[model samples]
Target: MTNKDKSHLCWTIAFSVGLLFSGRAAQATLPIELEVAMEPGSSLTAPQEWTRILGKMNLSRVRLRSIRSTDQPSVTHVQVGKSTRYRVLAILSHRDELILPKKHFRMQDRRKLQTYFEQLPNETQRNASPRGRFDLTEKQFRRLFTELSQPVSFATEGKISSEVLHQLQKKLTLPVVQTPRSSVLLELSLRGELQGLSTGTALAIVLRQHGLMLQPEITRDNSMQLTLATYDSQGDAWPVGWKPEKSIRLIAPQMFEQLTLEATNITFAEVLSQLKPRLKVPIVLDHWILTQREIVPDQISVKLARRKTFLKGALNRLASQARLATEIRIDELGQPFIWVTQFGKDSPRATQ
Candidate 1:
């Protein structure tokens, strides 16, 4: 054969082989689109069923290797390969029957799952449990679902006062207690409609306007209670004038026993202030003692020779000079508080 013919033949073979491989690659990457007539109301009841159905769906490019249903109802363990779209579609197709088991619905992207859950019907959500049903009461579940799933979208003209806000909260079925001290009477000029925003988000916007927030408290009956309160920057929202004895008892010994002193000519009050942030715990001076003595914390110079000393020992040594003693007190919530009182006065002692 002539060199020119042989060259042409080689080029033709190479082109054909290239086309074959390209076709194979395209076919491998293409998604399998199925048009099955799924039974109405038919759903995969368990993780095994989900796995089997996904396998039969010819998702060769994707893998749904395993599904674990035995975990918490809000969590699902799904082992999947690179294709997230198929997995999301499969889960959504059987969303009503599949217990997602995840605290947050997440797919290929974080926001996709959030958007999906936001659009889920209340009935579908109630049924989207691994156990096939929610254990909470209808009212409880409704409250939770509304808070989690519903987006807040409302615009109001004029100023929104605390009273008006309280009324609005009632309209949303959120319970409010009208306490004389608990009234958050800040007026806000709010004007914006939230789109696809959770109830918590809506409440946060309203609360931020008034420098307040919602906090959960345990009632005397051991039931959960939601309260509107002043926003604490430090995130310490203990009851007013309340101490934390239980927490202090549990924490003080560990914190103070290892306390090391290295102050150089700093006032006792300054020392306390420095210790306060370092300890990362709550410590308050006794108001009665401060009022009675009219002593300034910054004025009282504290001289502690650099030494690693236990908190109790350091406090005892400094107490005489500062005219103050330390005590752990309990609050209404059974949490502990550290109180610095007059050294000689009758005061509560730390729990052993």
Candidate 2:
């Protein structure tokens, strides 16, 4: 058995934020606990590879220690008997071993590692958008992903917010938080019927409609819950989908099936409606940007010249004319969907 109180580290960067050695009990809540276990046969002292790992992190808010294993005590790790758990174990393990198996921990990933020490739960938090430090460690999320991916067959369309959450919580065996603070989201009517999507994907899509998300939080005493929240620009919001396991061509061969086509002065909405039946996935618009630009799908006109091309090529030409962009996104379960948004950069893909 392993002690939960202390953190183990394979990284021994020069501690900058007055970092203490791994012996003192935590006096107050610190940043998220990180367990950077040394890979098998790796050295306890700095290695050339792990040293570069330190440079990759934005360590201003993070604390670190040099310890050999989980049993070793360190100030930067969690305390025994403390309710809170380590944000993640095997921090610098390199292999995701999760949905993103091929991924190397990136600089962007550092945001998810910290528990956002300053943004602890507060009653006042409800009045504002649900922005706080992300508490779900990568390992924790991977364990939960498979269940989130499997679809629960039902219509969450007309159900009120609270009841929908209750059913979801019962199914997943995890807390689904909708505190009084975020009451505005409760009792609000769902804009459209949700069918044929997994539990997590369905919930994420609904929340995104209102700029909210189901961010995981590990409360004290090793308890865990997924909270409904709105994140600040910097906070890592969990995503509705993962990268498709199969290549785009393999996943949707119809997208590449060639055909001669010409579209003249057709509204974007008409084009999508005509194409919707041909593809297996739904084509969704970026309503947020559309509202911002006061551009309606039916109002924008697209013109494409006669040419032999794939469905993707034809859509790209139409999307460009409508000031939109397109990409393939898969749900946690590897179900692909087509996303159409204003012509601009894509948001970071959420894979929780």
Candidate 3:
């Protein structure tokens, strides 16, 4: 062989030998055991302590290839690729107990695994990674390994591996509500009105509000339940003091339902504000809305002239209220006016 070819072959041989030794070392970490103290409803206490132990194990040079969470409460299983045919590490209990079979794992294997997690695509390795930042979590990582010997995926049918579920849970931010019950739990939220009205009435009101006349097809009661936010315990903003502008008749069942629907979905604040448009103190009103509908959409052309008139009018009104002398100047639209002060001796000067 040529000199270059020989050198390349030597380098390949050295790399392969190094990898073999590395795998052997990683395989040495296995068969770990842990004892956990259970808290009612809570998986485990002292999770932070377990994290610290994991940090230390990583420092000791142990390498972990995969990790998985178990159905057993307060338990996580870790796999060391080359440790043994059945090589696994278990973390358990609220007490954060760390145990292992003799000669199962060397600290070096843990260290290598920690390094691997730190370099992952998502920042799942960090304990304090904020929600919504990454697509996965540490809990999911452990569950991923316990299933298939392959990578995580959703296509697999029939009983899904716990790992895939964990990843999906992370991605969707599904609240993990574990009761004393043995099976997994899930919850969904409903968004319209429910508490404010009866089922039939609520449906009718929603239809009316949406500008749709109530029909038999839509007359049926909605199965969805609306969840309301709890008010502050102090009762500073209680609803007792509210003064609604208009009250609609609710004599019939359908009418009762419609009123309730409007009550819950319609904001009192927004409705009140809309009713008193002049309350904005500086609304840009157009004489056109009262006179011409056709030219209303083209408000942009009159905007600057209208704005000048608005300001002048405001100043004139303010001067009259404050009992101050003022002369006003306005542009095209009879709106805002510019305020000018006439001196006893000199020319009148405009006050901008």
- Candidate lDDT values, in order: 0.45, 0.57, 0.27
Total backbone collisions for each predicted model: 13, 8, 36
Q: Which residue segments of model 3 deviate by more than 4 Å?
A: 1-3, 22-352
Q: Encode model 3's per-residue lDDT on 1-352: one tens digit a residue.
A: 5656644543453344334334444443423322322222212223333444453432212222112344232223344685312222443322333333222222335654444333321221132333221122444332322221122223322222233234433532223322222122112111122222222222222222212221211001211111111222231111111122223121111212211111123232232234233322212222211122222222211111122223223333333332223332221111222122222322223221
> Among these predicted structures, which one has the highest TM-score?
2
TM-score of candidate 3 against the unseen true structure: 0.15
For 1-352, candidate 2 gives per-residue lDDT tens digits of 1232222333324243224323322433543444343333333333334334433332223333342455332222334575433343333332321111123444345444232322322211221233334644555666667668767477766677656666666778777777564557656655444567677777776766665667777665445678888734465556656567678999888899888888887898898888888766866555555666677889988888899999998998898888877888777767778877664433454332
Candidate 1, residues 209-252, lDDT tens digits: the string is 44565564433332444577766554422222234434543756
User: Which residue pairs show collisions in model 2?
Assistant: 5-78, 5-79, 5-80, 22-73, 22-74, 83-221, 130-230, 239-350
Between candidates 1 and 3, the lDDT winner:
1
Compare the candidates by lDDT and give the number of the best one: 2
- Model 3, residue 117: distance off in Å is 5.9
Range of the 10 consecutive residues with the lowest summed lDDT in candidate 2: 94-103
Q: Of models 2 and 3, which has the larger TM-score? A: 2
